[model samples]
Target: MTQSAARPAGRRGQRLTYLVKRLEMAERARMEEVLRPLGVTLHQYTALSILEAREGLSSAQLARRHVVTPQAMHQLIATMERDRLIERRPDEGNRRILRAWLTEHGVQVLKECHRAVDDVEERMLSRLAPEEAVAFGSALERCLESLTVPPEGLARHGDRTA
Candidate 1:
């Protein structure tokens, strides 16, 4: 059993996984509230941010980066394309491969969202010193590294039963 499962039910909240899950839910809720007025969901905002940093990503690549399925990314890309928030063009060498990029309007919207997100982040980290904030982020990264495993390895170990 997991460490958290070993704990008494009433004290489960004190476990790392429970606390992390709670924090993720609360943060997502707050982000949704703040981004709703801007007419963009957190996932869309994240896609825009990713496109900003790495232009010309395929829908499949974006899905992997976003930790979502390719079908979901395709739907999201279609909606964003319809709204003119993103533009998709065939790759130069491979006509079958479509690359996505943010439009001017999308960039402007992202700038506005950045300000609002900054406010939320500032408020969330207000209690922490700068060093503490950095350390906390590093710790989270370490936890993520520990949990992540190669799919091939999972198959080799027959751990995919669930």
Candidate 2:
């Protein structure tokens, strides 16, 4: 009998990719549950956090960072603007480009979200020791870089290939 035929099927937990996807889904669900009462989704909170770090990202730039299409990002930006969580202004160098930044209210909301997220993360890492948690984070970062970096190692941040 073949090696594959010798084993039973439906062993999703044994697959690395399946476990990764399952973890991602669980994290997203928990984040959304906590963020819902704050009138923000996980994507919106991510955008807000990004804006806080870099205050002048264009819609296209933000979309690229989020790995989403520009049209979808535009809709998200529109919703954020409607909620007065962020404001956009024409870029000084490029009149056609709109750069976004967090409003005062946005900052307040983001701070609250940070505390809530910190709680979630603390719970998630509760089983691990501090050193183990650090190692786990480093491992995850290495895994991400392995997938994102090009085979030739020529691509930088904005130059990632599909």
Per residue, candidate 2 scores C-alpha lDDT tens digits across 101-146 of: 9999999999999988898899889999999999989868766876
- lDDT (0 to 1) per candidate: 0.85, 0.87
How many clashing pairs per prediction, in order? 0, 0
TM-score per model over all chains: 0.81, 0.85
lDDT of 1 at 37: 98
Model 2 segments more than 4 A misplaced: 1-13, 154-162
Superposed Cα deviation of residue 17, candidate 2 (Å) = 1.4
Which one wins on lDDT?
Answer: 2
Q: What does the lDDT read for residue 36 in candidate 2? A: 93
lDDT of 1 at 79: 85
Over the stretch 74-145, how does candidate 1's per-residue lDDT look in tens digits? 999998888888999999999999999999988999999899888888878889999999998987775564
What ranges in model 1 sit over 4 Å off?
1-13, 149-162
Question: Which candidate leads the pack in TM-score?
Answer: 2
Indicate the worst ten consecutive residues by lDDT in candidate 1.
153-162
**Clashing residue pairs in candidate 2 (N, C-alpha, C atoms within 3 angstroms):** none
